[model samples]
Target: MSIKITKMIAKTHCYIGQNHPNYVIIHETDNWAKGANSRAHATAMKNGNLDGTVHYYVDSQECYQTLEHQDGAWAVGDGKGKYGITNKNSINIEICVNPESNYYVAVDRAAQLAAMLLNQYGWDTSHLKRHYDASRKHCPRRILDEGLWDNFVKCTKSYMKKGTNAGSVKPVKEEEPAKLYRVRKTWADSKSQIGAYAYLDNAKIACPAGYSVYDWTGKNVYTNTTAKTGTQATKLKGLTPADLIKKIGPLFTADQLKTGVLASVSMAQFILESGWGKSGLTQKANNAFGMKQNLSGNTWPGSKWDGKSVVSMRTGEQKKNGEHYTITANFRRYPCIEDSIGDHSAYLAGAKNGNALRYAGLKGCKDYKKAATIIKNGGYATDINYVNQLCRIIEQYKLTDYDVKAGNTGTDSKPAATTPTSTTTQKKTFKVKVTANDLRIRKGPGTDYAFTGKYTGKGRFTIVEEKGGWGRLKSGAGWICLTVNCVTRV
Candidate 1:
């Protein structure tokens, strides 16, 4: 017997194509009709005012036909085309029930109906989909959230695997596996340190000369629960610090304070390095970490407590290279959090020293590891362990949470701590091409002077004048081109 379907024709145009592959989309009526049949919807479709109809309907008891399989239907809208799917190549099936009914049966029957359709086209269960999948609508909301779709896929795959369709599943091509990379320590051989720990779970393994290892996800070499491996230790979503308020509370800006992790890291590291901001350098000079001094200038700005002598960096030459030891007197003590974060980022970024090396490839360094390494190897910090400690702190205390945007509000509008360029709003001017390259013009009507644009040798002005450069005089005004003008000593 041939399958029969009762369909509702909406006043909308049917969108279907013949060449496209057939896709079965299932939906729920979400009606309150008793016994799983929605008479109201059927009536609405017959009035010519109806919107659309599905190919078939399955209730708790029996199946009802709405439309013929071969006939075009208007259930799925044209918007599905946005997802590269067209209704012409698809079948829409609806299942009606009380929103509070046992939804599992609907999902099960939907899968069965889908299988029936799949058999017609010699297609596998993969061709079946949900209305939500067709477009971004939240229709059949309950079925999707209950994981019915995943369950349906599993059942379909299982049934297909047992039959002639077993070999029909897309074949998995065998290829070379990806190469495993090992992380290396920048100064693993240095004499100033005790050996670092190897894999947390694999006590039997030791780090090789150039490689350092960590297993945050416990992918391998982990047996004991005590080991800090896998996503557990590295996942810094939720961590509680004992001395959060006491150590780093006062130092955090409004933005930093908003992020719990960044705030915690700042507190923990500061306490570990400066002893609660009470260390000799911190108490007297406000140098929280006893960061080495390197400069000649005497005036920067700092409160003198106990006469401990403060140092500030001089703005003579930017981008210092290589490693220089001892305090050269160039360290500055920032009075606020805004300056500290900016300076810290710049100092490690090399961009801080006006050296582009640190900023070269650091933009997408999401995790702290890459950012720290780039800073360390890029020669931003003299300390070899700088990157490691920074990365570790960021990991340990989840410092990213406390990441505050570097800026200020209200009375304390000190220019940001990083480069002065960041605070300055430079005018954006597009290059306007002139008829001639390197063309020069006069600054005044008396042939006094001047120059616009790029200097490619032959002739052109490095600067362009708007009005007074060449006013009214004679012989086409006093505007003398740079090529025609003679240089006069000012």
Candidate 2:
């Protein structure tokens, strides 16, 4: 069956039609608000609200063509810079998803669209690419997170062979859920690194030192298990040197604390770099550790920035000749120490700095020494003694003792207890359609409340309550204003 294309009106400047597309660049809408689907995205494109233009939006039911394939869309941010070839000669397709949409269906439709476009242009699966391959902003996050990008390409290839009626072209089957395995450096080590895989051979290949595999129900499956798998018998059984634990200990998130990045190593790095938070950057700008400005030149949507706030300082750089010299460089300024800590984590996690490929093996590394070694080898610092210095600080402070075993709780470990509070107020339920772009949903009924989320373009939502012209969403995310002419009752 031929894919239905709903053409959207667009500004003449939105795209250039002379350049024929040679590749298909894939992206995700990234909007998590309810009902933000292909039609909604089409509306946003027609209204001239989208920051950039894409050729098509593929949803579960239909594909909306916002720009012609012969034209160059501004989806990739290179803008005549690096990867400009794709931007000048590629078709961009955005797969839409939201709380109300079926993401798998959308992805399947996107695969079909990609295959059709490839066939039409006489191209191949080699022409497929994620938005990240062009500019590295981590677009199509769901596909990447689930390790489905390769499968997507394979499905597209299958579709190309089978023609438009390629619904039977199945993606690669997902691997069976593997037993969770924990590995530690020593029995005395308080924390262990966790990984999941199906086969014992794969688990053994991961270097089985102080390792134990657990079943789906969190029961140890290893015949001769020595590794601890459950909650600690005693809380804070081993304590780090109280004097060595810096004031920044509480800044780490629970997930970060358990991320196999030894708290001791991170703390020592912070103390050594920031001089116990007494540096000029720390005192003036709350930048406890020196992190350079993002050199990628890509603006991620949710990242924090004031645009004008920055600090320049001289730092040591090691040359290929093994000589160190001081050079001035600009560093990021943070509003709080928390942001600095988060940025540091992101730096090591390869979220910033555009060097994710360099530090690919650092995540969930239980051994602090190995982590240090990886960081050093990943070119995190020019200092040849970086790993040694970090290890020395960790050993001196006994920081590994402070590391706690991660709980066996699933994805959302901290489940909140649901207790009904006293409430006699009545609420009427009604359906409403969002009529505005970028509508903010606040925690309360007023603008003064903190924004919980946002809706891009137009969408439909169920209002369960109304107070002073503010409507509370049935999803319980937050409240939106009904008084603002941006929403109408359905």
Candidate 3:
């Protein structure tokens, strides 16, 4: 499939392109207004109606190139600051998702065009970035809001590998698959007994002097003393209702706490869903909120464990007729309590979930009772009395105190507190030379960020700001992780 690039008439005074474009910035038109598409955007650019310019406009049908690859477009709002990728070093591509157009189809074509550009420029997926990365204006709002960024990247990578030939490869040794074996309780209580040994011999050795060994699937392998597996299994760490509140009270992010989600509601939901973190799935998997394994085609990102290894436990579902029945379903497993809390916050926010517009009213609401009602009405829980139960939990334990501490003043009159900033001070600008192989300068501080360009051996850049060991390159070239010793100060 070839991407048709329609060029527009050059405006004499428009942006000048860079000779070597190093970054690809993705954006959405967000103009759901009538007749919005590649052609309309191209017309706007041609007619001088648009102030900012982009290199390409991708709709469901075709891609329009309004500016040459050598010219820079003012697509990212960052402008030509010290970080000048917006108009100096990056090619901007906008996807058309008007009210009438199919956004999914537009995004699909956009990804294809992005892959083609990457291949043409000899760039990798690391160079692909959203407008949000350049400046957190939420430009590609729907895409990031719906958690489809990963899916888009996956699509790009898939297209990148399409025609590459594998040719001949040397035979490689394969390692044994990891194994999980269980030890009976008599050998040691399940809590003390190491769960899931990597080897059967290790499990046998760990079975104490007399207990039997069983596979993780609970199949009996051997028996020593009494041949009877002890019936008692050690309980996982159990927290009292008060302890649960204290444990999770301070864990909420400032953004989440400010989003109008009541801390009392959050804590109550955790208690109700996790059963004070004592439920089988909660104990085994640390999934405190009982979130489902996946949403549509999207699973929770950055799961430490194999997401497929889920804990299926019985849950109560209430029908419209007020009848309750137990059913077994797989739930997501988190690596730690923090992950669970973070996911819970994202779920309530809904924007990070696939349903970006759903439960929007729950965010930033001051009334805990109203927040619970909104959650219930938004289909968050099946129980009819879910709101009442949440309210009861909040009242029973005075969880409102935590909400108050979270900066919810009970009245919606005052603006929420500003997001807390890191205490680390940025060091003064200094020059540095690239010391590592092909060090990438990213749009942000973390590896999760998109690369603006790569600096090979001996390449130098001026670091404008430093935070968390990441140096922001001068002239908006992007950021480099200085902690890895990739660049040495000169």
Query: Top TM-score: which candidate number?
Result: 2
Point out where model 1 deviates above 4 Å: 1-21, 32-49, 159-490
Local distance difference test scores for all models: 0.40, 0.60, 0.61
Runs in model 2 lying further than 4 Å from the true structure:
9-11, 77-81, 84-86, 165-490
How far residue 47's Cα lies from its native spot in candidate 1, in Å, is: 6.2
Candidate 1 total steric clashes: 37
Which ten contiguous residues of candidate 2 have the minimum total lDDT? 231-240
| Candidate 2 to truth, TM | 0.41
Better of 1 and 3 by lDDT: 3
lDDT of 3 by residue, 1-490 (tens): 3455667854633556453588888999867776797889998887888887888897765567888878778777564344445666788889897665556657766776787888887889999987766764555755753445655776666656552211132211124222345666543355334333424544554354345677645677865463322111112244333444455555543325445566668877876665555545565557767777764344433333445645544444667665544344567756566666666666666533354545668777768898998888767877666777677656755666555443444454222332213314476899876644445567876444654544434567788887544678787878776533234466
Every model's TM-score: 0.32, 0.41, 0.40
Candidates 2 and 3 compared: the better one by lDDT is 3
Deviation of model 1 at 299, angstroms: 46
Native-referenced Cα lDDT, model 1: 0.40
For candidate 2, the lDDT comes to 0.60
